[model samples]
Target: MTSTAEEEVLIGFGTTCYYLVFRLMITTTGYGLAALGSLIVIRTINLDNAKSWREPKSIQLLCSLIILSCFTGYIILQAAHAFIAIKAGIGGNPVSLAMLLTDDIQLFLNATIILVGDFVICWRAWVLLSEDKFWRYFLALAMIINIGINIADPVYDVPNMKSELKGVFNVLDWLSVACSSIVNLIATSLIAWKAWSHYRLSRETSIWRVGRQSHRARWVLLLIIESGALFLVLQLFALATETGSSFSGSTFDKDLTFVTVAKVAGSLWNVSAALYPLAIIILVHTNNSPIEETYYAGTQHTPVSLTLLGNMRHSASGGGESTAF
Candidate 1:
């Protein structure tokens, strides 16, 4: 293992030591970082003397906690699979049927985690596009199919892992990823469009508005970001890794570069999954989230005009009661 020009000894296989350490590191560090994010989300929860637990902030808290719990279960399954593989490699033994069964559960959890994380991102799009019936239905139908594939993939994977039906499984996996990626693209586009429209609406409606003019640009930036576009940034990296994994699964010596890319990017994804919802929670807490009381509040349905806002005081100088909140 020295830097000298000597022959390098290889391990039993690619899936033994390399994979095990990746699992351990991913579960440990990813969970720790997600837990820290959860703490920040929890801090946003108010112990108000007047508000209910069903408040928006509390709901964010609950979402974060649930996501973390699901991620924990997934990590446990991965750690267990990695543990069994490591022991088998050390003892110069083949994995038993039961260990393969454990692998099945891990695959199931993998699908589950992806479903939950993607669903959360879809949920953001849903909220942002609340008034757009077309997008709402489109997203709903896509997610329904996404859900079907996630469920069916694991069922097929269990048998395909032992048999020659792996190609079918691969096709299903590719479809699943394609479905989710399309949804992500739509969500990102919609959010960006909404942000652009919102900015334009703000400019037109509120020249001498209530807030600082400079802040509008920042708010529009935050609007797109808080809407889950950040997840797409991480999603691209994860997809690159997934593409490499698709080329050569559980291989190191043959495609070392791709394998390393797959493993490293996947580890980043473990944190990025939880970071999706956690990012929303953080924005909601920081008041960077779009106005929670209404979706697309000023862009449609009821356009906000600052004309009244600018001259309301002048009009009210006659001392009639002002009705604005």
Candidate 2:
């Protein structure tokens, strides 16, 4: 290769890296904003009722903390990366400049935050599934492994063959995706299938099951399925990068695109998670009260008593008998 062509290749690589840095900055900022929005939505919802929210308030609060921590950590890491990239572009030593200039460490921290977030998601999924002890152990093991991998990138020194070791670090970084994706896909598929089956049975047999018309469960299932799909796409790209194909660039670009889309989808999931409990609360309160009576106390029993008598008659005549009988 000619001198000019070699320099051009280096320039191109640098430009690509810089472009990715900007993309990461923008994406993480958006995620942080979405996190703030989710926080607001959650606070607005009254999730104090047990029947509406299956998870305890304490657990939900813990998950909210993890979500916020992950958001803040990612944004901080990206901002640090941007600063380092700028310094490096000006002919500074990339490795000696600063902590953020070391992409390996920064990426490891980012991946660590994401993995913790993934485990919280898995915990929520497990709660929804009511699965056995095995799932709990499995998720715990995966979380431990992911944390170990994240620590290894910065803590384990292998300066001799940094390039090859860096690839190994990349593999570790993607392990969360691999493990969580598989688990989520299977669990979500099962949950959706179960919810759908219950809904169908409710319609056919007139049974009143907990999850028969559970929009929350259905949305959780959807979130899991979507998360799994995104993870699979990411896994395929990781494989492409590993195999040393020219198409890896395309895969890398697609991976970034997925990250962007996933951040948006994640925001939606946060809203869904928070809104699910709130919706249940509203629906239950409405069903249990007389709207007209509540609105106008003077006209209370006129509409309220009639509706109550009608419901009782239907219940007695078995017109609206629930199979829970």
Candidate 3:
């Protein structure tokens, strides 16, 4: 790496207060969200612990435990790494394994979080888009590609991460984020299409006539928002950070700013990825599809594909209602 980059990473915490503050802020947000996620997981498990292993709720419970376990460890390690670096002062290089073992374990936790998070997203999309077999197949294929990228990127980046390690993984980091964006884009689009089709069907069927004009519009938008919209935005920020940091084979900022941006971006992606499922689980366990229950509460007609909130309890006989999730 360049002398400036080396100095930035090797400097004491006192010298890079901006980096420390930004890094701390990122971690704090992640820390708080992680804590909340942990509570949600606990509440979920406590409520549904009596559920049979054959129950579908068991699948969600299992996923929540696995994700929250990894997420808590990852955030705690990040917090510890920061403090350790601060204590180590000029000897610190938290970004590198040479500084501590945090980097090594972090890589494992990160890969697991991203891998599982992506799977959950794809699985949600697959379940939500039940009627469309073509898109389901397409989504599965995209997920397969997503799985391969998440696995291979870390394996390839690790050797390079240790040697000649820098603030960002440069090209590899951006590539991974880009792949994530593409996969999520596909998933989100499928959900939006399904939402729109169902909303139009509701309108034509006059179920939407029971309310104000914006009711139909609001319903469709809510479905889109619930289905990975925020997560997609976070992925874009992560992608921008990765590409912005060093697109031309050089750090964008010569000072501690580059490290701050990279560290914040890394933390941002980690917490956001984990929180996606946490949010869904929280919504499901607590309110159990408020949108579905609220809008379709009194109406005799419920949208065929109203699984955005995962409200598909059982497969009823219909041409449109398919619980592939």
Candidate 4:
């Protein structure tokens, strides 16, 4: 079918918006990579100081490095493929099934990134709530379910990329989003609760006579909550955009606006997911202080103590050595 003048104008606008979003994603990806790189360096230094490669902490750092490397590589490759496809005249053209397949691949990569992110957050929750097996099992179950949904999505979506099946795909996609959102919300709440509980316990026991140590612990907790909240807000925005596009599917039959919006939302969501962990690592790094470490040394392990915040050595005298989260 031939395009109307109005439809042509809309397509042009959609294409412009897509490219703008594309540029934004690239910029965000660059920042994310830089942050990840710095984290790797800092972590490596910490590992060297610890002088033990066999420790669980060292293994965790190694795994994190590997995941960040893979995530960065995938983002670059997907961005390049997107640029090439658009240059080959596939931009804003949803009817091009091959281009659509490329998008599906990107979606799969995004799901992988999100899976890694979810695992990281869940792991943090597990450590913070180490004594609570119920919360640990709950978070583990949620992470598993979320990962299952994410893995199932691309498998179901790629094969059924038909106009008639768009709604079905939307349902599957949103199902995954809903699972992830729930997991994030629950985990963040648990972390916040643990932090607050620890603060209250320390106050009641007079374990923290000086307000400075308690203040630092609260700062760490606030940083963690803020980071989680930021990521959740971005995911919610992505979900909103997807819902809007799904609802407007029929009105914009050409699918330009919907396609552009979906791509933008997906890209932003992945970028935010990648940035969240990096932000947490950097925040912990910057907040590390020699004075704080000395003061915290000889401190008993508490539920929401700095030890739970990062990797720290427990002194023989029930204190803590300098650590990074």
Candidate 5:
């Protein structure tokens, strides 16, 4: 039988291997999905009759490209870091290993991706609520708070940082998650409300008209909810992992599960965050079916005035303005 020390070493080695494989798989898969999503978005934009290279849709495409590039950079860095750790051996000091894994570069990239994601979501919220100052101000405030917190996060990344500082770091991380969740939740609610309002107005116009518009409005609402739900779930998972690891102390064996969970959740979060905007763009472009035109056209005959917000800006001819789905 192997000695106790030998068995412990084996366990550590096994854990390290598991981490590397898991990271590699998730990172690669996530990146591939983001790439595919980006391509679809670009293709959809190209096919759009109403949008042009000089339009706001083009700007959104640019933003998506930038976000995806950042995510790619982050994954590359993470892969390198994991390899280095494998070479260093997991038998080293757990605290130092943890600190190395959560290095300055990684934190910076994460904060950057998250900040961009927050901006995209908030921008959408602003466009949707441009007419309503209350929601616009509320979302603006949330974005400001989230951005400030994200910018301040990198400062606490010192080598062998103090326990008090670590506590502060954890607090900042949790605060960011909380603020982001609030922003997403509020933004999604507002968008859904607007879609519901449009649907209601369509129903009053004509049954056949409402049937066409209802399908398109439902799709828009679904996309918004899906995106928001994705972020909220990932953020909650990260928050739980971080909280658990922080309270678990320096025991590597005890903290391994928490750390692993956090890493996986983070990988998925980065990819999903990048893809979120691209997915939105593609969905909006695909939603330009005859149903949309019918819905908008029917609105002209109805006494009710429906204001379509965001990328759905179309000409006011008999057809209602095209809405960004």
Candidate 6:
């Protein structure tokens, strides 16, 4: 009901963007729910397999299920954010919408979960790599930083805090993004390189070939992780442009463009994570019949005659070799 053309135009644009965002959010939420279903199916299969084999553990399958659970929660949170974004179309004010965006406990919880997941990935990578103590310490530091950010977010998010601390927290948040990304990029690259090295070292050995397969699988995982990292950079850039331009009194067109770009980038970032499982599926093959084969090769461990000798020793010792299990 505004009389001004500028007000009408801005409202129109905001409504359009909000609609687009809402659509994407719904799509993302559906995909996440589907992922959760898929994980449930996978978990059932793993549980059945373990039951049949009488095996007590399936670590890989367990990890996948956990990731799926987190992703499911993420999708729900995204849907909530989408609702907030769309609230603007129904005569919601910008500042009110901003407040709504920050008001959700779910948003903060989701962000924290994501941050913790990244830390877990980094720490696990270091443990697998047998990396120096410094890597673990660095991971700890990153986790602490992330926790600090989460704690400070509420305090700094008071009314008009956007005008007060936008620059400071935006920079800090972006820095956190950068730090996590660099850690993953470096760790995954190193893992890929090491895996490739093993592949090159032994070409003809079938059993040792599993090690190479593991390497390939790991390489694929690394690529997915790195793609997510690159997307984070895009997100940070978009955030900077969108929020930064607002404070600078940029043109309406520029503001619209920046916000649209940021929305697209954020959608891509979410979709990228969802697609990681497809990457693993592509990397797997008939040659890599056993799930462990690729991981074995990637681990720099070469199966040898010593395995046979150890088996014989287990039989000779008559204790069923507790180490093997």
Best by lDDT: 1
Model 1 root mean square deviation, Cα atoms: 5.9
Worst 10 residues of 2 by lDDT: 288-297
Q: Candidate 4 deviates by what RMSD?
A: 6.4
| Model 1 residue 60 lDDT score | 57
* Model 6 Cα lDDT, one tens digit per residue, 3-72: 7987986777576667566646655764665475445546343344244332212443444455566666
Model 1 Cα shift for residue 97 (angstroms): 3.6
- Superposed by TM-score, candidate 4 places the C-alpha of residue 238 at a distance from the truth, in angstroms, of 2.1
Model 2 lDDT per residue over 13-65, tens place: 57646565656655665565546644654664445554433444444445555
Worst 10 residues of 5 by lDDT: 295-304
> Could you tell me which residue pairs clash in candidate 5?
296-320, 311-324, 312-322, 312-323, 312-324
| Arranged by TM-score, best first | 5, 1, 3, 4, 6, 2
Report the error of model 6 at residue 20, Å. 5.3
lDDT of 1 by residue, 1-325 (tens): 4543322323434545786787578678878878888888777656453266654455556678777877778678777777777677556565767578887876776676677677766766776675699999998898888889878878877886676432232666556666666777787787677666655554554433457475767766676666656666666766656754554334532576766776776667656767766776677555566533233222234322233333444444554433332
Q: Assess the local accuracy of residue 84 in candidate 3 as a C-alpha lDDT between 0 and 100.
A: 68
Cα lDDT, model 3, residue 23: 65
CA deviation > 4 Å runs, candidate 3: 1-17, 41-55, 90-100, 165-170, 209-221, 246-262, 284-325
What is candidate 3's TM-score against the reference?
Answer: 0.73
Better structure of 1 and 4 per TM-score: 1
Task: Kindly give the number of clashing pairs for every candidate.
Answer: 0, 0, 0, 4, 5, 5
The window of 10 residues in a row where model 3 has the poorest summed lDDT is 290-299
lDDT sort, best first: 1, 3, 5, 4, 6, 2
Encode model 5's per-residue lDDT on 97-188: one tens digit a residue.
Answer: 45465466777877787787777767665555646998899888888887887777666654434344433335665666667667777876
In terms of TM-score, which candidate is strongest? 5
Candidate 2 colliding pairs = none
Question: What is each predicted model's overall lDDT from 0 to 1?
Answer: 0.64, 0.46, 0.63, 0.61, 0.63, 0.48
Question: Model 5 compared with the native: what TM-score?
Answer: 0.74
